[model samples]
Target chain A: MEKGGFCISTMASSNIAILLTIGVITVLVIQIIYIINRSRKPLHSKSPRSLSTLIVLGSGGHTAEMLNLLYVLQTERFKPRYYIAAATDNMSLQKAHVFEDSLLGKEAPEEVGRAEYMQIYRSREVGQSYITSVGTTLVAIAHALWLMIKIRPQVILCNGPGTCIPLCVIAFLFKVFGIRWSSIFYVESIARVRKLSLSGLLLYKLHMADQLFVQWPQLKEKYPRAHYVGRLM
Target chain B: MGDIDDIAKEKRVVFVTVGTTSFDALVRAVDTPEVKNELFKKGYTDILIQMGRGLYIPTKSTAENGSPALDYFTFSSSIADYLKSASLVISHAGSGSIFETLRLGKPLIVVVNEDLMDNHQSELAEELAERKHLYCARPQTLYKTISDMDPGSLVPYQPGDAKPVAELIYRYLGFPVD
Candidate 1:
């Protein structure tokens, strides 16, 4: 009787251990699959379909550079585009209008006007305090997440800007968690001839951008991972 | 004090633009009596200031007479119109202003806004000055710098083609580049 009781106890303990081992293994497999999916390359197809692109427009020079870049893209290929800018950046919004007008050019204004424009809270203002920046950054992040959910863009393109940080972060998080599929392309500003701007530095360090392009060869040398694509503006 | 016609005939017009961001320090520097005297001595009869959301308003001064030789606006979208007629451009070291001035082939003197977070403008001003494309001036020394500037000596800016930038974007988007 004593021998039988001991055998039963041992069997129960072994069963528990086996159950725990299976649970751990299951978790490991799920984790591996998640990482693989997150890191997978963006979808590529031989037969091209129209892609929805989210372009983050920074104020002033960034706006100008981005407009210059957009002018060269095949507009038909990147249909139903969206533009995101800071709420305070009236100039950028105006520039976007100018860009749209230039593309429309007295022909089919209503069709091209389908490209949407939205604004996110600015993360930082010139001469703002650090504490204020932190608060605003949080608000900006929330706004960016909301916009991302609404847009569900296939890809995001941004030149260097502090305002782009929150959107990039939200996009990266969504990509990692399997909430959405989107690739980020960061083009270092033409003004950044020698070094990456603060935004560029952060995005590169975090691996948020799938592809990075620098205008100058020297900048590419500094950031080996970044492709030297020559000047854009 | 002199008449507008008299000053226009005697002195070169200098356009002082601060872009879209407020640069009260630059505006204040330009507004000083000492700076005004220096400007007058240097043959700048008319100073058109594009203040751009600045709090400081140039006080109406009899120094330039009733015609208000110092004309200022809070903002204007058509800065190119002003740029066309100005003999010299004094501006804050914003890239937009720099590029626009360069595109217009105007001789520019850039005063870096040191108060900015990264001081990128100072670096840009130095770079442009090194290339002989523009001159860099300090807020304190703006008047002196303008007094000595020779706009004719500055190198004409050559704008780069945007095609390369467009091609890079195309390649990144997986579109076939022609």
Candidate 2:
């Protein structure tokens, strides 16, 4: 009789375990759907005019393309900008500083909508073998998490640079939580006429980037989610 | 540091820039006597080569006996300053150098560094070239391209406005557009 009781108890526990698993999964799915619907909430009549913007700058070509994008933006609306670059990228930050200063006709951009410069460690350096990048990538992500919490930007903008990946992912995490939903905007480099860049591909696949811009129409055809901006650089 | 205009008025300069990456083939191609002879025929009095990590460096000389003056530098903080003074620009197929020169209304010949993976730069160069904005050439065919160059036939590139992109960003962010 005791053996039959033990067997029944074991069956009951197993059934409970299965029930718990399904319950957790259902809650998760519901939460995911809720978040997706929440992200789609458009501007109401009460939306704020100014945004705390985070601009991801990178070496050479990426920096130049980003700066060109900055020129199009109405600086006042994107006030109190945070410019982020890889720690080793000295030129991008300086160029962005000069650009912001130029906007205000000043030597230093002391108050060009309160612009600030931030540097993060690059997850992978140019020509770095992928074997060792795993560790460095984790380190970069941790560093990016810290920066993202500090900035908590309303909008994050990046071109095709490896440095932006960790930050964009963290921004999506923010959305997952009830933290500020910082929308990520990615612009594919004009030089990449045919393929979506590795960075572009990542953000697209993960649904991290809210809007993806491609200079070439061919890229848009391949990446259906991408908007054909037509020669942004 | 002297005026680019003053220098440009003195003698027609052809600026050959390999951009930041080494394109040794372009450096070597420009150094050829055949290419130099063609440049001279086109009334280019001087050549300023921004070598950019190239293995081979061209020897500098003055136009003593009507031979073309040749000088080269490794890199510069302001390649735009050099581009401003040049009558013609032969640059590696870098978008930065290509657009900077084109936007300045200078005639540019974009040379493809075939060594780079997939030759992505060629696509950008070819598209612009088709629009009659610049000439596209390979290192092997640079001499032929330069010899047949017609700067007057090229059209000035109108810089694309980013206002539309800005508006899109604003709309997405829910910032009301003025």
Top-TM-score candidate index: 2
Query: Where is model 1 more than 4 Å wrong at Cα?
Result: A1-44, A106-113, A124-136, A229-231, B1-11, B32-42, B53-68
lDDT of candidates 1 onward, in order: 0.78, 0.84
Q: Give the TM-score of candidate 2.
A: 0.88
Candidate 2 docking: what grade?
medium
The DockQ figures for the candidates are: 0.39, 0.53
What range of 10 consecutive residues in model 2 chain B has the weakest lDDT sum? B59-68
Interface RMSD of each: 2.8, 2.3
Candidate 2: global Cα-lDDT?
0.84
lDDT of 1 by residue, A54-73 (tens): 99998888888788778777
Which pairs in model 1 have colliding backbones?
none
Model 2, range A1-233, lDDT digits (tens) per residue?
99999999999999999999999889777766775555455445366767889999967878898998998787777778999999998999999989887898942454457889999998888788898989888888899999999999988889967889888888887776658877788988878888887889998876678888888788889988788887765
Question: Which candidate number maximizes DockQ?
Answer: 2
Worst 10 residues of 1 chain A by lDDT: A35-44
